[model samples]
Target: MGGESRIHNFGAGPAVLPLEVVTEVAESLPNMNDSGFGLMEVSHRSPAFQEVIDSAMGRMRRLLSVPDDYEVLFLQGGASTQFYMTALNLLSNGGAADFLVTGIWAKKALAEANRIGDGAAAWDDSSNGFKSVPGDGDYSVRDDAEYLHYTSNNTLFGTQFNHLPDSNGKPRVVDASSDICGAHLDVSKHDLIYAGAQKNLGPSGVTVVILSPWAASRGKEGLPTMLDYQTHISKGSMFNTPNTYGIFVLDKVLSWVERNGGLDGAIRRNQKKSGLIYDMLDGSDFWRPHAEVGSRSMMNVTWRLADEGLEDVFLSEAMDSGMGGLKGHRSVGGIRASLYNGCPVESVEALASFMAEFESRHG
Candidate 1:
């Protein structure tokens, strides 16, 4: 779908992608790089796919400013797998890790860590209905913790850590699934960063994992081959038939980012797009944003109508107005507009106008 057929896509994941990137992928689908092998049917061991993976990795490293020593892998199974995989490799021998349970994903990350070792929450916002991310002073990491784990952005509640949480000098491991490339990130500060590519990078089934030297070399003595980072790293991210098409599309997307001014451009666009919606939310008491002012997410802007019963009406009107994916997550039960890297500023303006029109009619 292109041009008029495309509506404002704000679905959480398997989300919107750049039209340029999508067009390139679609063109490559039949015969990639003139290799005669379709993108989906190409062998992972082939030279064409090798070039694709290498380019994807190089672009990610440059875009994120990842340390030279850090290992970048394009793995399968999304960010959810890394929840247990991170713990399996980092905490397998038995050690404590502290977590900032900002939202559902962080809670799940910590719970998975506990199964492998001792994972405890240093601070959690669940009791507060996850309205904000905790300030460093609000939480205390364990003295003996191996590392500090946190989800950089809470997709469900639209809360994000504007500043890095104080890890108390421990290595930081983050699940940055929802807001990886679109948000401001210091890859060097964190020992490990794992993100599912669907949100901003490209499509689902491809995960970007960046690991520091320590994390790369910290594999346990007898980790299961598939779950172990070393296993994939040793084979150069080809432990199994990698996500061939996903990686190719990722490379194209990253190339698009490079042409569009890389990470800085993405950050600026995300801020601008989200700022428009936030301005509307803040100006009107008719709309109530879910996250605290200081902790709002630029990628996922979530909110409720002042009259809760109007939410369904709001979503319906949004769809009728040529907007799609305005529905909230089932659990969150409100509207969530995901302004990932791929989301355009024009879409936000359209939404803001729609909101104003709706409020004037319904308010």
Candidate 2:
């Protein structure tokens, strides 16, 4: 399929998947493991489905190097559900939370927490035009706060926190939806890490939650059964009907990552791919990158043409040439090329070449 098409995907979330992984899923969905029925028709209590979930969790642990202390949960809904769940579980006894406001998603998370009666402080970084990370001075981390929340990578802004900030003694919680499996990290520092599987793991609908058992044990009561983390964890994520198809695809993608080089291998490839694009952006003044240099994201590379009018021209020609998804978020009007793990190095090269040709003609 890569050979037959000139198109390369660069959307922020619900982004690209390995073409090989997609083909494998397509072949397996109809009759997974040669079972009499399709995966969708398989019962959750059945041994076949148990094997599926077990294998999926095992692969996740191996790929991410998840510790025994952390429980890998395949939960319903995307990262958005995590906003309320995190607040409900962590602040159950009643305490404030702190969030470093970097982009739309962080703001949304804080807003959700506020609605749940958890007071949240948005760390001030507006002075830098939202292009840089927040300093210690920008926030007053409360000793009474249950946890400190932040998005590891801002997909919309093209900014990322390569290293999570040290919060003294507070537990760190991260919504790594855009850059989770694409890199390696010390998961011990975080109380909980949740990422939707759509971007690099698999298709949309299911979200992966990795939590310290202590964090999992504090889930609040009085919530609906479906929203309770304890309920899902106890049921082995098979309570009621599951998003079997999404889990199936996730299993395949995990296999792909394992074969290609686990977490370290993924980080190496991502760094290499984004480095090529960043080098091009830095060398030519014809294009100006939006995010602060040091904080720029390896997953989402956003930039703008020197002349604003060239934006439309670039988008039109790139799509015509079969290189698309380069248009940035409407809120930030520019171009964003999301280089998720599944996206090959060759795609990045195609995009760079397209940019050079377009600029040469228009410059």
Question: Which candidate ranks first by lDDT, i.e. highest?
Answer: 1
* Clashing pairs for predicted structure model 1, backbone only: none
Candidate 1: where is the Cα deviation over 4 Å?
Answer: none
- TM-scores for every predicted model: 0.98, 0.95
Separate clash counts for every candidate: 0, 0
Candidate whose TM-score is highest: 1
Q: How would you encode candidate 2's per-residue C-alpha lDDT over 143-252 as one tens digit per residue?
A: 87778898888888888887767665788889988888896567888888999888878889989998887788877767788887888888888877888888888888
Task: Name the 10 consecutive residues with the lowest summed lDDT in model 2.
Answer: 121-130
RMSD of every prediction: 1.0, 1.7
lDDT of 1: 0.91
Candidate 1 lDDT over 1-363, as tens digits, reads: 456689889888889888877888888889998999998999999998898899989999999998899999999988889999999988745789999999999999988898889999999889899999999799899999999999999999999999999999999999999988888889999999999999999999999999999899889787789999999889999989888888998899889989997899999998999999999999979998999999999999999999999999999989988888988887678899999988888888999999999999999
Q: Native-vs-model 2 lDDT?
A: 0.83
Candidate lDDT (C-alpha), each: 0.91, 0.83
